[model samples]
Target: MKHTYTDAMADIETLDTRPSAVVISIGVVLFNRREPKVKMKELNLKFGKKEFRDEQIMMGRTVDKETVAWWKGQEPDAKRIFKQANVTSMEDALNKLTAFLTQGDTNYLIWGNGSDFDNTIITSLYESFGMQAPWKFWNNRCFRTFKGEHGHITRPPEFQGVKHDAVDDARQQARYLQAIYAELQKYNILSYKERQQ
Candidate 1:
């Protein structure tokens, strides 16, 4: 089996969970999930609220009232970028994420928390700029589906950060995916080499 140590997980905090949602923050972690001790590199970015979101809304992007209502009930720290952040314009954030993912000429297996949420929303943001997403569409993976199929890997690794802080959230999600993948490997249902395929 060929060894291709190319994998990444990205998480985003957005105003709405839908494809047209305005993204507030993006967190991406590069790691080898098969490794026993995960080593990660991170790319974390925040979007300027009024400057970014308002422009997107003017350009036909959307916000959901219900999602806003839900955010109101969450802990203050969960809304990480909302309080204070070194923010960038919408396009700049996307460019930074692209640069991070495409570095070293690696073909990354990009995984997002949900098949339809994180990746889809990010892709939409890229589309607004008329640019292709950094990773190939064929390389996209969904951790939500992976977890659903491996339900018995019930216990997650200890989470050590605010739930909705994008950087911390991405790191924790990567750990969870690694844990689940290790469990699958243990059963010999799929081997390390097979997973890289």
Candidate 2:
């Protein structure tokens, strides 16, 4: 028999930057790939005393001017999350995310939009705070590569939520991955042995 389940999947959202990046939020969905069940958690962080200012860097977080400008072109719902009231401090957010990531003892495949984007930014944030990231380096996975190889995977009809909202994005991506994996299995394109690796 072959393994039918993946350990877990995590989707993170961040403010892109040079040198270092600021993680705006993290949304993780813990699930068994064999089953259609999942548990979700999200953390929203306050990067600085105010948005897009030197205070973020003074607190050891990086911000980029171009990235700020780019955000202006995004959807309004996507932009609203950033200004939501009562966001937690970066330290508190990190701690909560760490707790969320360790809820299960099993090692999980942490899926990010790109292999180097979300996970890299989070790891950098951990280093800046002098804390160790909960997941190992090898546990990182890329959703983009999977999508590219599999072609456009669509979201389930039930998920009518805003994109760029960390939790919603994570859930949608997880569902798409599950769909893609199942489709591959149906066509016998992905063998059990290959999947186990």
Candidate 3:
């Protein structure tokens, strides 16, 4: 609704939609992305349930006395981060996210790893609900950040390894966005001052 075809409008259309983020992490860093500027909402998700019990199983390892303590020891710092997270079922989470996206004329879904796994989960959920996800930006855009060889770069570190905890991954993915924003600034794609208005 904010966009209109006016005399001053050019042929070029800048896809200025802000992206909604969903993260999944392990013992490593967090990942996330904010919603569109018009929405003024951010969803932060973290993961901390490291030790699986009798019914918990992952990566060919079963939850038992021998493995419980070892996994528990690896989870303290991550647990602290997610102690107050907004946890929900994957389906419920997708509903909340889609609701937020539909509030704006255009929106994007961003993840550090692109749409392979993260997008798959979300789109699959959307399909299950008999709704189509708005993911054109996700399919079209590719994120890239500069790596410093000699000088310092002011970007968050890259995410490494998989922990499969949704919240943790969101935080890590958020960093990649910061880098992308920085690159946009350097090339005059966008600026904080312009975005604020």
User: Comparing candidate 2 with candidate 3, which one achieves the higher TM-score?
Assistant: 2
Question: What C-alpha lDDT values do all the predictions have?
Answer: 0.80, 0.66, 0.35
Q: Which model is ahead, 1 or 2, in terms of lDDT?
A: 1
Task: Write one digit per residue (lDDT tens) for candidate 1, span 1-197.
Answer: 22334688889888887898977788899988778464689888877357777878877788898888887888977754675546456677778888898888678888898999888998998887777798888889998888788856657879988888888888888888888878887877775555645
Instruction: Order the candidates by TM-score, highest first.
Output: 1, 2, 3
lDDT tens per residue, model 2, 82-121: 6653445666767877877777556677887787777777
Question: Which ranges of candidate 1 are over 4 A from the true structure?
Answer: 1-5, 191-193
**Superposition error at 60 for model 2 (Å):** 3.4
Q: How far is candidate 1 from the true structure (C-alpha RMSD, Å)?
A: 2.2
How many steric overlaps does candidate 3 have? 18
Pairs of colliding residues, candidate 2:
none
- Evaluated at residue 121, the lDDT of candidate 1 is 90
The candidate 1 region of ten consecutive residues with least summed lDDT is 79-88
